[model samples]
Target chain A: MTGRLSNKKEKSIIEAARKRFAHYGFSKVTMEEIATDVEMGKASLYYYFTTKERLFQAVIAVEQQEFVREVESILQKNILAAQKLHEYVGKRLRYFQELLNLGTLSVHSFFNIKSVFKKSFNNFEKQELLLLTRILSEGRATKEFNNKLPKETAIVLLHILQGLRLRTLKKIKGQQLDEKSYKNLQKEMTLAIDIFIKGIKR
Target chain B: MTGRLSNKKEKSIIEAARKRFAHYGFSKVTMEEIATDVEMGKASLYYYFTTKERLFQAVIAVEQQEFVREVESILQKNILAAQKLHEYVGKRLRYFQELLNLGTLSVHSFFNIKSVFKKSFNNFEKQELLLLTRILSEGRATKEFNNKLPKETAIVLLHILQGLRLRTLKKIKGQQLDEKSYKNLQKEMTLAIDIFIKGIKR
Candidate 1:
């Protein structure tokens, strides 16, 4: 019963922190404020997350974990390889654009970019590569795709997705992103995916 | 004579800074060191470039300028559309991989990421898009490629190339680049280009 209670408290803390982060971002949200919001002592919040960065990691972890499930569902969809790939890229564009928006929304900013975050991000990338490789191999086996090297192709796919992510998430240094820019960004992503789809179409 | 002399001195300063920047990266190499390498007084160095960052910018500008020239040369190459695209991408892979290497080499890091750097990079990106658009259009006109959206296709090609650039230049946090890793990176680029080329082939 005590263990369950602790688990419940932890979830509440994570959720409270997530809310604050969504509003103020990682840097702006303070532990004490989070504790006040959760109606817990500041010390108790420390017991949950040792550092602000750690708490931020936990917050991002929730999103990334959800993303894993999303990728799995994309894989599970009973669809053709070309369509599967196209849909998957579309999902990635949405996910990243949202992440970009979140980053912009937050004050302290996720861009604080701790080493721990970098480590976890690399692990996530490996997972993405493995998942992409599976999709490509399955597609090749069905002869729905004929890219001879699925592993490499998978990496390229991720890279193409990443290129789109970079453009969407980060504004080009000097150019301001207006509503039209965002629309154009979306259009560009769709076009890029079409090319990738064509590239791999059997 | 004054213009010629000043230009010559500016070239020597840029060369010295480039060599130092390549060796110690941006943050590590001091203005004093670059001046010494150029055998000029520190004040003279300042006269040429008021700050270390500006000098570094000049060094990078030299590269971006060379890249423009290289793209022009690629456009002039006598080749079929698919082959030209393939060759152009290869050139990009090498150029960006080297830029990535240079970034990894510098101290304080190019990631110091000044606005000036961002503006220039955006400009370089624009140049790349224009060049890719030309090649794609030329290819389409000859019926060597059949992508219906050459302008959008050009952007995707550049994005794909940029994707390759990011992977080759930067290490994934937890991963080490061994000989095999290097070979795999090369193979991945080749395979990606092959797919893109095949996609466009009429």
Candidate 2:
């Protein structure tokens, strides 16, 4: 029972840290602050994760792993390539919205973590690109998509999705985005995707 | 002759300071460091700009004004809205490339400036949004673009452009992008614009 309690405490600490880091960014956040938020001694926090950097990296790793798993599960299900693409885009956007709602999609923190874990981040990005490429390739073979540069198209789609996600978050934070504005964004995204698919169709 | 010489000195100081701030970011740059680069006394540097923050703001302001002017000139030309958008997009992308090459588009510096001049920056953003909305309204009225949410579409386009600029810079630094990759980015931008225009047309 004590071991289980300790494990739960560690999990709570990590959750609090992720929220803090995402809200304040890595450079601005301190271990002691996170420790206080978690209601644990700083030393106890250190015992769980040797350093602030490591702790932040671990948090990001876990998030990325979970994201990849969700995406992979969707992709692995047997479906038409077009339907798979639609699901893929929908899932990614929905996940992004959830993160934004949780205040875990801060651009500053995202870039900070990228710099700190450049190699690992790059590897993760490459894997994402590969998955996208596979989807595009399958779509083309099945005549669900037009033949075009898969990697290039994938990057474009990723950028658009990311852009939409950030804008949605900004709007929610009263940064020139309101409900009406958000709805417009959704419409534009849908149109953009439709146009892209249409342009590339054989 | 004396006024001319002083003007030359001021220009040199601004140029040197711009380079230092761009490379090292505002937090890391020092007045003395900028002075040394321009072979001027630190006191003399102070005569031109009262504080580092002011100097940094001045640097961005000058560039911002020039960028606005260039974009305005492109928009004001008597041409079809489609041609205008094409020029606008191409010119903006090129400007971002030039800024990135000059090391003036660092994410760190952008955030620093954003924090330092939050109100002013917000005002600038609003003005930019207005400009985009005007262009989109014109495009739709002229049947150059499909009728859609101008503001939301503008926000998405702006974000994508910014992301592409950052990604391109990262690639140039031997970090993530390559020549082929950059060409692909350009292609995607072209494709995105084409689809947007097509999707909006009646």
lDDT of each: 0.72, 0.66
The chain A TM-scores for the candidates, taken one by one, are 0.83, 0.68
The per-model DockQ list reads 0.50, 0.22
Per-residue lDDT for A5 in model 2? Answer: 29
Q: List iRMS (one decimal) for every candidate.
A: 1.9, 3.3
Could you give candidate 1's per-residue lDDT for residues B1-115 as a string of tens digits? 2352358788888888778766655666788998899888999889988887777667777887787898798789888877777777778766654554444335224544667
* Tens-digit lDDT string for candidate 1 (A1-202): 2352358787788788878866655556688999999999999889988887677667667777778889899899998877777777777666664454334334224543657777777888898898889888989999988778888788777876676556544445323334776677678767766666677878
**Candidate 1: docking tier:** medium
Ten residues in sequence with the least summed lDDT for candidate 1 chain A? A100-109
Candidate 1 residue B100 C-alpha distance from true site, Å: 5.4
Runs of candidate 1 with Cα error greater than 4 angstroms are A1-6, A36-45, A50-52, A98-119, A167-184, B1-62, B97-120, B167-185
What is the lDDT for B57 in model 2? 63
